[model samples]
Target: MISRRHLLATGAALGSAAGLAACGSGTPGQTADDAKKSEAGTPTVTIQFWMGKLTTGEDAWYKKIVKQFNEAQDAVKVELTQVPGDAWEQKLKAAQAAGKAPDMYIGVGNNVSVQVGNGELADMSDLLPAESWDDLTETAADLVTVDGKKYAYPMLFEPQTVLFYRKDMFTEAGLDPEAPPKSWAEVLEYGPKLKSKGRFGLMMGVTGADFGWQSWGWQRNVAGHLPISDDWATAKADDPAYEKLATFYRDLYSQEIVARQALGPANDSSAFGQNKAAMMVQGSWGISQILDEFDNLADKVGVAPLPTHDGTGTVPVTIGNMKWMIDGKSKNPQAAADFIKWAIAGDDPAVLLDYFKTTGYSKFPARTSVTEAVASAPDADTLNPWRKVIADVVMPAAALEPQYDWTVAEAFGKAMEKCMRGDDIPKTLGAVNTEIQGIIDKLKLAEKAPQ
Candidate 1:
């Protein structure tokens, strides 16, 4: 493992060492003369970046990472910037219109889908290694892949959502703490029991819905009912699978098993802390906060994978990731790709495993080696089991996280939101599916039209 001592030592530790320690050898992004002068002068190459808020003290960690890269390599210096969560999508649209979008970005699974189709993003395939990238997890590669061509360098591979339960409360309710429901029917059965105890059985997001995000067909991708076919065309949003999943989500709330909360207003974990609900369908990352911030209830909490519709327990959940694309218009494509490779190496399973263990989150490495290293991690006792699940349960499902440009998902989210709010299902689904078809056709991604 790379040590902090090695990272902090300066001078010889400064330039080439930084490259070797981090990105290794960079493909030259500039002529020798251009790079030579950069080393001697006040070096700068404003490569704009858009990424989510990293909790690790950004100033303490990220600023240092960027500075080291700039000093270590004459490649275009990264001009780090934040894309505020709420306004990220809006700002991206505005920037693209002005022809001044960031050179690199970290966005959600759906954003890539939209940008890729609009030709708003650059291809990252040429710069990355084609073979021997076995360190990357099977699913991590899928997050940024489309039609067999890779676009994004995977950043983090995580279970998009997980189920959380209370320990003390279960004991008081005379329920076995170790035994959580294994199927959706079990959850419904337990809901009434939880309610009898004056505890809210389940908590839903602001929409008070479940079916919107995770689904039977689209989310699981088992049916291959993509808005675009393998080539890129719209398929049916009203397919049997879609309707079955929608009913699954809606019935929970209507049956009083899931309750609505302030999820839309702010972060969802905060709602759980208020003690208004007993359980939440939350991201695996939340485990860290619950254990850290809510010390009073730390031991009282335990985690279990969500109950599935059937005993199979297969989840549609996936690892969320974004690719780092080089600016096609960049005069220094080589340099840009070099920086990107280092930046994305964060996905290398080894790197990810360290991050997940050290951070106390449920994230698994995007690479296989990192996942294997769990036995050696200081936090192995906690990390190992989750690592097994990520490698086997979660990683296998990750291949389904919409690798094709996400334009269809944009339509999917909008259509679902409307229907969740009681909009006409037939009209909304029809219109959204039509819009998705147009997007697929525009991108030349779908091969055959729906009959």
Candidate 2:
């Protein structure tokens, strides 16, 4: 599962820090002494790299890659540091203030937008080969590009929400295990039938904060636009579509289809694995957790795209991915770029293929070549049977996560929670409009909205 603490930090803390100007700090202490010539008289460049600790074997995979890169060359050396997720923002901020930030660091999902706005990321177009940029899928390219300048090298892509259902429970409830709900109305129709003693029909985020970011894709799916106007000048939460969307949540909560007390956070798969819920809406990363912690139920778990509002079109999903970026103020940007190229965008697909394998195929590759390599792997189907559904149905329907301030999303989330608690829908949404308008005006967001 994706780290909730890490995501929370990115949305809350980093979002608040995006307005600061880029610091003109000197290189870190470690790189200061590494400018000396090596034994052969060739100059050696030392660059620091930082990444967050992950529950997946990604930390070990990154370490192994760093070791291999260090041993295979002498022109450049990478010093790696693994920071805890919750501490990442604070540590990085401290380093930036001291002019000791790492030359390269991993970029969290939508946090890249904030970083780009702060001018903290360097353009990779000049550092890497043109083919490296061309290798990215169109969607991946669009995600890393802002104002036509590429800023990041994406590593992986994951759809934010997918439906995971228990086949055994469906069978016991006299429902067809082969056919799951394809629409929100069908989900409500199916929920009561699937519920039994000590179990809920569905599990999802019911609180305000959780609802804020988690429901991003759902908002687009239902309302056809986000809470803000296209020009980012006005609030659009008062749209009638939102009232329809709010009513759906109210029905789900009032009917007790979803428990008032959640079994766990929406990201956690333990509740589903232990049979507390027959159906769950979670990210693709949860598949890895299920295979690792509940291997016995792997066969019984089924994956599909989240249901749509009217069941007539593709359900929009939020795409979340990690990327590697160079610090704009780094003294050794070329060295850092070379390392990223060798590890992820190199001609040889072996390194990236191994990452997907090590992560149990839970994440999808960003490059077309890597995707092709993965499809042709020796044991592709045996590793994960749901890969086809995710790669085809879910991924093709995904939209990039919104890059606006988290505060805007929080206002809508609070409104959603109030609606679920049986508050006046018109009054709740009017408050959302006022709150978001204040944010837009205070931040001067209209002037900064993407052209």
TM-score of 2: 0.85
In terms of TM-score, the best-performing candidate is 2
**Clash count in backbone of candidate 1:** 17
Model 1 C-alpha lDDT per residue in residues 371-449, reported as the tens digit of each score: 6665467666563334454456644554345555555665676666566555666677677777777776676665422
lDDT of 2 by residue, 1-451 (tens): 1111222222122111112232331222223233233334343667899997665467788888888777655556789999987798899989988888899999877566667888788888777778888889988897888878889899889988999999899999999998989999999999999999999999988888778877888899999999999888999999888998899889989988888877886667889999999999888988878876786898998998899999977778888888999998887777788778778877666668988887778888899899888989977668788888988899888888877888898889989989988999988998899999999999888987777
Off by over 4 Å in 2: 1-37, 40-46, 196-198
List of clashing residue pairs for candidate 2: none
TM-score of 1: 0.74
